[model samples]
Target: MIRKTSLIAVGVVAALGISLWGGSAMAQGDSYTIKFGNVISAGDTQNQGYALFADLVKERSDGRIKVQVYPDSQLGGEREMIEATQFGDIEMTAPSVGVLANFDKSLEVFDFPFIFEDAETAYKVLDSELGDEMLAGLQNSGLIALGWGENGFRNLAMVKGTVKTPDEMKGIKLRTMQVPMHIAYWRSIGAAPTPMPFPEVFTSLQQGVVDGVENPYELLYSAKFTEPAHYLTETRHIYDPEVILISKDFFEGLSAEDQKIIQGAADEMVAKIRSLKATISDEIRAKIVAAGGTVTDLTDAERQQWIDSAIPFYKENASKVDTEKLKAILEAAGNTTYLEAIQ
Candidate 1:
């Protein structure tokens, strides 16, 4: 009778163990919702990549996680959305590195004019240890940096005339993103830099609030800025990168497995965004031309002139950002000339 009673007790314990294990597993699978927001249009390259990320996360998590992407500032403008993410009011956002620099000053290095000669160089630096360190800096500000997304190279689009060199931009009232580095650079070069929100740019250009605005060709074309500002120059001045951000609070609350799923999907999103970006400039330039806009490419000499003009701006502002990190980016891009000049 004692042996039989012991066996029955063992059976009850086994059943209890199984029940507890099942309950824990179910708890581990608790559902989560990520509200991903961006200022880009619904079908823009960035949004498309974000959509892929959302899909991948949901599929990988077996529907335990759902990501809802709100694009075109549906949630709010970039700055607003960034703050929302920081406070966990929203789950995610991707903002220009320049805009993000407002929250984490270290990112200002990317806003310097002509910091990168090409997209490949930008990618090399941003995917390196230095870039990761810079991204990690966001944690103090309550953001989780996923990966860098490209906004391509910002070029000039003028309403009246082509601006191929710094000399051409003198006294030209230009609209700029309200980034300090951007404003400082344009102001240093004698342009009347007008800081304004993105939504106001089109009308600002149309109503003569500004003579020209600078952005990637894709944005200029898509936003119909190329229509009002028909003179497009391939200055490729600044390589604007968007930073994928999440709320640190929200991210920490996630299960490790779900966090891995979200992060892995972000990595894939970066790759896909870049792959689509590889040819987007040329493609959009064609579209701009097809739409009755004149596009101009700088001669090697003109490009060099633009670079030289940036020296004063760099010398003045480089000291304001993290010198070591800036040096790393320059080294990564093989821009020894600039590194030497800045020092």
Candidate 2:
């Protein structure tokens, strides 16, 4: 009878242990390994922010979650990475809002040229209710949009000469991101816009396939595009914010605790990325000049001319997007002219 009782007690204890272990396993939900990808170099600000996110997730999750970052299109270009994330083939990507707009048409308003005066105004719009509403639309596209990251203001870098006035852009074969609004704006301004992937811009510039390219100073200097296209103009034509995205399906499968960690890290990343970008333009402009690229700035008059040139573009394309959201962004940016015109 003593032996029988002892065996029964052992079986009860074993069953209890198994139940506890299974509950714990279910709570953690099959340790997730996130594959994060981007098109920038490993040392770029975006990557720095992503690395921080990965570190925070690993430390906070007690090593249950592992994040691996693939920079410089190692996974693929922005569009491809986004698609991969949507299909659950990859885990995450930070794509320029322009690229993301192709998937969520509501985001297309962000691609409008000369819409934002500076990073501060851009941030105000993106951090407001309007931005959250736009981000919320991503659920339909299979992406869970995190907060916004910065691409900084895109400037013109040419192989031939500096472009100050809108007329100066005439007939220049400028390489543009494969975003329709961007292409349309350039075409309206009289430039022959050549749409291509980010990876192709540098070689196209070097080979004379495209006479010039436009991007943030950080990208131009980091990617060595300024080496081939020596004339850099501080056009500040567009304020592009990259949207940090993850697979909605994968995100939903995680425990609520893990979800909080991922979301918190993403918020931290936005702050880090914007802080870095806030001060990086001047630093990179100096680097470009030191590397023998000619850097030029527009006069106040020239800047106004650039702004005025976009009126026609805004008129034709503003109706293509959600006008109410566009108005909200304009109101947030204090773009009274465009806002009034649209209204």
lDDT for model 2, please. 0.84
- Pairs of colliding residues, candidate 1: none
Best by lDDT: 2
Residue 178 in model 2: shift from native, Å?
A: 1.0
Tens-digit lDDT track of model 2 for 44-116: 8888999999999999888989999999999989999999999978989999999999999999989887788
Q: What is the lDDT of residue 90 in candidate 2?
A: 92
Q: Which stretches of candidate 1 lie over 4 Å from their true place?
A: 1-27
- Model 2 compared with the native: what TM-score? 0.91
- lDDT per residue as tens, model 1, 116-149: 8888888888877777777877878978788888
For residue 204, give model 2's deviation from the true position in Å: 0.7
Q: Candidate 1: TM-score? A: 0.91
> RMSD per prediction, one decimal?
9.4, 9.6
